[model samples]
Target: MKTSLKRFFAGVAAAAMAVGGLALGATSAQAAGPVASTQTGSLTVKAANGTTGHTLKAYLVAAYNSDYQAASDGSLNFDTFKYVVTKDNGTKSNDESAVKAALTDAGVKASASGSASSAAEEGLRQLTGQSAGTPFGYTDGTATASAAERKFADALAKKLTATDSTKWTPSNVQDLTPGDGKFTADLNPEGLYLVVDTYAQKDGSKSTQSVPMLVGTKFANAAITTQPAGVGEVDMKNVTVPVHKEVVTDNTGKAANNTPSYNIGDTVYFHLSTTIPDYSGYAADPTLSDPTGKTIRQLNLDDEFEAGKFTGTKVVSVKDATTAIGDQQGVLENGKDYDVTGEDTDTVTVDLKRLVNGADGAKTGWKTGDVIDVIVSGVLSADATTTDKANTDAADKTGADSNGNSNKVTLNYSNNPKDNSQQNKVPGDTVNVYSFNLNVHKVNQDNNPLGGAEFKIVDKADEATPLQFTVSGSTYTHAKKDTDGAIETLKSGADGSIAVKGLKAGTYVVTETKAPAGFFQGALPSYTVTIAEHYTNDKTNTTRTSTKSGDDWLDTLTYSNTPDNYGLVTKDATSPSTWTVKNVKSITQLPKTGAAGIAFFSVIGVAVVALAALFAVRARKASRLA
Candidate 1:
């Protein structure tokens, strides 16, 4: 029996060893398989403004371990985890009730289990694959408990060191330092997780995990400035006017001095000084008169020196007489009424009709110290009046001056018949009068009048369109030139044309009366049309030039004349009525020659071809031998 029992025991022992070996092999195989993916779990703790640094560290470690387990398994469920937090200096802390309270306020539930170890164990049991009976023995070896705890501790240390002493404390919980404490844990799971160990001191000092508690994924930062919706409107009243140059002269005699001439619809500005004490009140009045008795139409204060006060400066527009008042008058006397003598003659004339027809007509004749209205306009014409001769003979006749001295015939008039006596006439004042001198003479190269020539003023170049001239109280007319370049009559139309009258042959210039409106008159040309002696009788042959042969006979002559269609000239003397012909030569009768170096180059090219052939033969022989 003893032997049988021994054998039985040995067999049992052998079987047990076999079973243990099988289990060991299976465990080894499981460990060699792919590691399971991990998830992230977060634990956030908040404490009062002033909490002990050691206490904050302890809380962070405990919270990290709890979340890591809860995320690993499903059974363990603990909000807060207890720990014995220690600083690098070995300073240790017990239960951190302030940290626990802060965590509770931050949405963390304190564990009723109470003990740090128990809370940690229970939290671990809350996650999957993590229980007291699990493969990891409820310690969450697969989770990041140890790493997370270390991270949380380091963050807590940084937080406590960076706290500001004043505005923050454990109780008041104000002035919390940003990122003072932080915690982060990397898990081997599909999701992310984080554990934040944060604390505040009673004195506003704070300590948190060094790294921010991260869970799941990260989000992008927010934008700063945004684009505007629409553009702003511009106000013209607030805009400034651009400055421009203007010409201000004494009289219309220098009208050409108006550099920038005014157009019909141009807006012009004027500067005027007033003797009036308070010119500010006149700004609102369109018709403000100056001290010189000149009226300003559309008068306005350019700008105020000291608000609502005028510095005697005014602006006015240039337009027709009725539009701008006081523009036609001269300056007025200080503290006095309008004065006709002091008024601007130009502006007064424009406003004359208005003054004469209105109540002011009785005071038409101006003097000093009278309140008179003046209109300002830029339409002052330099050539306001002009004169023309009624008869050429009368116009050509020389006249004697008042002193009986012989002078050239000229036209003269009293500029202002109303003031014929020239009572207030001044050199600078504008004058209205007829032409002073006929100034009829030939135009020279310098545009000056030439002597000893009577300009044959014609209406048209066609001889049939002869011009009529009044001479010595009689009218003289000329006719057009015939095919022979001679006129038919000197009194009336003949040979289907008009008579050609006699005139002094010389250069003459034709000019128009007044330049069309809106156009400036250009300077006249120097040279004018020449009326030769021949043109008086034969208008068509006016510009003809004759060349005589040995016998003084007109053999072959050439004529160059304007208005070319009037007549023709014969080239032969025997038949002076018709033209002759002549023969010309061909162009190919000229010379030709060969290039010098080109022939030599051609010969060299032939020699180069021969040499190339010899070399090719030698090269072929050498190849065959090789």
Candidate 2:
């Protein structure tokens, strides 16, 4: 296993040819092979309690073989990992038959099914035009694989197993021990190597560990930007695994009665949470007055959301996991405590210079399971979509059709012990703010839609102030109560249908603010809708107003109706939930303007005839007397 530091690295011509087309990539630069050098730096595996790297071996994946440049694209950069993970998609099984055939043709005994792995290797070499038994690990540029091997990079997955084939310089290999997180290793010039910490247990088994990658030339004071410190250094660069944050209206367990759904004119309360870094070498300050201290120095977290989805003005509350509702004392003030910035106020940066500082005690620092909660008070806007990456077009917004509107939020925080620059930060997962919608339709006795019907929606049963609504991307959206814009008035659409969207579950009154033209206002009274829709725990249903998450039961709605002037009206099922007014006119008493209304005309006619007869008789009598 001993390798010459100069020969293994300097053996430019001795190393085997790389996969030209696939895993090696179609890029000519990658195909050209590693650029070797003689520079070396100290690499260490850092663990919570300072566990040694044990059996971890650093496999040289690529090499520039030159002096290390600060910003130069190192062969082992993030892009290389991406290519290996995403692009060089090939399965070792693909070439299994071909390899076995080639091995059989070459009179070699091997099997891809595990009977004899060497059989598959020999077959690969035979097909790829390499020496019969070219070692599976990185060797001097001597072995060669066929162009087809690049197409099936994953076919070599079996060959790439085992750490014995590592191409480490003799000087860089160091023995790792527990409680000794740091191990110094000298590396050759410009080359990229995959260093895995294989911790060997007393039982003779090995385990892998997580550690950061440090790219420094001389190993002086903080050479490159992405440093987790010797203490915080673990894992790859620019390639971060984000732990998605949670967006909840209320995490107070219903003591706050936060509703997940928002009315058009209701201010939405959003709470965001991100986990704290877990560094094991820390002591909890025994005194409750002091804060907890850890290995971290400067902590910075930048949270961002879609611009228009949230109002420009925000009332933000910050608190750590240490607070309880009864105490209600852990609320930290913004600006005075943390430097908050972002033109639209959709983004906030919390500078935890003093917060995460371990100097104070066990009182104010972060730890495992400890969360930093950021409560942002913003009104859901007219232009909202589930994937807040972009705004929805007005034509695309529909009440029932509205895909759940959401706010896009991301978290980028410092990963290094001391380095707080953007370069040294790890990106957390994106959290989504979700809200639902409701569609409404106005129908006749036949349950057919009619236009010109005006209605009003109010949180209270009185239907006092008409809920203001606006249309965006063809969808009707309501705003919060305190919003400055004009609220939307409900009027039947061209198709005799209207929707009150972006509404949280609550009881609301739908009043016939204005009846449709050509139709007398039906005796049907206003419809009272009670909708309670939000995330609720099953047991907390009694204490809260909302239904369980995924429960469709909004508050019950009651509508009052009276017979129209024509007759008594009855209800029939028009839609799953439609109100159709059926009028059965069978009048027992004549209307004031009906048959009784003409009786006066009949009397007038009789009076006119009687008067004519009297005139005639008087005339006759006068003539006779004359």
Candidate 3:
């Protein structure tokens, strides 16, 4: 009878292996004998290197009575067989009455005649066929779980976790550590088991979670089966979706730069991107609007800017740049596939639920490995904070920590496919935009301060267009021009200082348009000022370095003035590069009328007599020679 039982399950085990599951088979060479009740085996699980730090639990779902057989084509098969449920107290209670009651509780009918109905046996077969590779009926050919598979899995979970929780207690549990890489469950009776990752949370880190796996404790022969003999080993698989953000060079978002500069009121383009991982194991909800629903899974992108520093926030487009088909369909549609909350505000969020599952039963063009891009733009408003350093680009020495506007973006994704309510957040790198100021001072050759000098500044890149500024007394602040009209000239203050604020990093030409009253206009060369930020690996001359929270980048600030003769002046010994323009007083004392005029005429008459004597001498010398 035991030999017949083993032969009956050979076909069933083969079916399971056909769809990526390992089949349970006898390890002993005595394959033709009646199976012993003391038969036992071991199961081993191997996962990716970095994914091993977690807790794994195994629960016995059914007890198989026989080994699996492999065909000549290397396919597994199990014969028709009967499986018994173990006692809830983690022991083998083979009593017929108790077995019948447990089977009844699991919606399976058991007969005293030792034969189950066809319907009941089919239901049990589905449970035993669960595979480690295709959890939730998600196979390589299927994009998601079918309706029948979802119903069966959900029903099984509810039954296993009912008031009788002990009925499904884990048979073995292991807490794996980093670099361990594998887990083993030994001394298990011949049975099919379900293994689950209890600590599958990938929060703010690179490690991703694994889905539930099914393993058979009883192993097959090495020659007959492809899997490892005596140890049913399965490789745990996972998929991760990492995100990246940057201030790009243009609206196309092809170029990436973490540190960029912009003039006040200039449009700054931002690019946010991430790849879509496999969502076949994830469950979909009936109510798309309810994120907290029992079955809804979520993946969102949250972005924030420095308060009041940006305006006209616009989500230019969100598309899947991986394939041309995805680009044509816009993978995720606004108001249908995702909802943009907090638009035009400092904080904006893109909620992506319907993008994975279809919206209104419509399929999405998105698929695994699709590269998603979110393009956004905003104007660098005048509300941005400005700084003046004791020295140019010395933000670390005596000024605010950052003299630039900044924004950050992060990805909130469904890390665990089994648990829809759980999420893990991974932050992208922070991006910065820098602007600078140019200071001018009017002085005399004696270095005395002279007020009421006027000047205009223009960017060397676009000389035809003069920069507009709003003046408060003698201070100049950059203002966006509505029309291409002439801009106002800025004058020096009583302290011989004029500051032009809110300019982007570039070379600028400063020209003096008017001189101080009653002073001869000094020949002032076109002063060249350059403002820029540079990155380096060296420790010396670095303005910003790594932080305790994992921000590690080296950079320095550079502000310089050409024609180092007058040199840059630091106001109050520290702040703003001030260029000093020197002037001289005009001559006013005229020559006296009588004395000066008579002296001038007497000198001319002396010069005329000397010329006549020279000419007569030359003529007499020529006649003698002739």
> Relative to the unseen true structure, what is the C-alpha lDDT of residue 307 in candidate 3, on a scale of 0 to 100?
88
Among all candidates shown, the one with the greatest lDDT: 3
The C-alpha RMSD of each candidate to the native structure, in angstroms, is 42.7, 21.7, 10.2
Off by over 4 Å in 1: 1-424, 428-458, 461-465, 471-626
In model 3, how large is the Cα lDDT of residue 432?
Answer: 62
Q: In model 1, how many backbone clashes occur?
A: 97
- Clash statistics: count for each candidate: 97, 62, 17
Across residues 141-214, which tens digit of lDDT does each residue of candidate 1 receive?
11122222222222333344344531112111112122333322222222212222332222322221122222
- The digit string of per-residue lDDT tens for model 3 on 292-328 reads 6536766788878888998888777777777544435
Worst 10 residues of 3 by lDDT: 1-10
Cα lDDT for residue 370, model 1?
22
- TM-score, ranked from best to worst: 3, 2, 1
Give each model a TM-score: 0.15, 0.42, 0.68
**Residue 359 shift from truth in candidate 1, angstroms:** 2.4
**Candidate 2 on 433-470: residue-level lDDT in tens?**
44444445665555566666666667674445666767
lDDT at 554, model 2: 20
